[model samples]
Target: MEKYPLKDFMDASEPIIVEDVLAHPRVSEIAHTLIASGLRSFAMVPIAVGERWFGVIALGRNEPSTLTREFIRSHRTLAGQAATALESMRLLENTRRRAEREQLTSEITARIRETLDVETVLKTAVHEIGHRLGLAALDVRLGVDKDLLTAQSETKIVEREKEQ
Candidate 1:
């Protein structure tokens, strides 16, 4: 469409009523096309999210008619309601995503705390993460070097001797 005046109105987050498309200064440029399309009169209301313009709702008629003050007020009220609904939906979607992430985090934490065995921890971690990500396969390589293993074993032995 006709972008000359409608676009400007939307950008400004305002309402516009054109009684005569041909005589209106803002829409005069596209008056011919508007008349050809059987749109002699039209009113547009902007849908804004907060201070920013999100979209617009327009009503058009083939017969030229004067737009009453009450009619414009009603259309503006409808647009405001639409904006509120959209914002609420966006917030709800965000909350849903955040809840999912929190649930996953809790599950992972519970799995890790379930056992002190390193092998069990690694297996459970990989399985949980892979399942959440929908991965076909997941491989976890635990590289416990020989020297580290020997040190750990020696430490365990010393602790056992002290206990005895």
Candidate 2:
């Protein structure tokens, strides 16, 4: 039915049901909502990560009808595949970010080793550190003074200064 009832039922609950839908009021409500939403018919299957119901996979049809056993089974299979693919993509993205961070660290370390001057070293270290960790506003307190100062660093350059 527009997938709202199925979605709502999942949001409001944690049960996974795939059998008869017309036998229950909640199921009927889903149908009504679907119809009101301009969908003539829909099939809903509860989606879950293990025993918990996460949501539903609903397919809409213009003409009211029911799905065959094979069709329901096939859609459920597709839903499972989609969920797995989504999880895989999330994992891949996380891995890519970690790799990028590590690569940045390596590159920064190499740059520091290639330079000998203290000023260049400090500047390079700070810049690379910020780059690998993230772009940020940094106040570098060097030497024994540790003098308080506001340093807004973008890349290797500081845009504003407030010494304290």
Candidate 3:
């Protein structure tokens, strides 16, 4: 990974400033590729917030000595703001998923309460849960004393009658 400057910079969580890519020993292996891409100098700032690191913000220039200390400092500030925005988006997505799960549970419970038939309740539960979880099939089993109630998508209901 040391052969790649971007990986090394991200691992160190530090800014990498190369004044001349062709003359830099650290990026020597990729110097020709960088020059072919019309980049003589480049800088990378790690996008991070506290201990969490997202990635690196890389910028390149066609001329050498273009990426100076001031340029890198400004980019570091930009990387910080980007990382904060990414973290905020992640938290919002998690909250949305949690709310969806709670809503599904409430809907299933309400449907179950409206029915007195055990078969209907089991079918409704398995169908809703399987669809929500993207499962191709689902099964549910309930036991009481020596009797058992089973439900499957393909097989339907199978219940043992209670002993008379």
TM-score of each: 0.70, 0.60, 0.74
Q: What are the per-residue Cα lDDT tens digits for candidate 3 across 115-164?
A: 88987888778777877778888888787886777777655554565644
- Write down the lDDT of every candidate, Cα atoms only: 0.73, 0.60, 0.79
Give the best candidate by lDDT: 3
Preferred candidate (lDDT higher): 1 or 3: 3
Candidate 2 local lDDT, residue 12: 23
lDDT by residue for model 2 (42-93), tens: 6666554454444567666656565787887877776666656766776799
lDDT of 1: 0.73
Q: In model 1, which runs have C-alpha deviations exceeding 4 angstroms?
A: 1-5, 51-54, 138-164
> Which 10 successive residues of model 3 have the least lDDT summed?
1-10
Residue-level lDDT of model 1, residues 1-164, one tens digit each, is 23544585445467888887977888888888989989999988888776756678888999889988999999899999998898888889999999999999899989889999765676677778778877766655444443121112111221111211
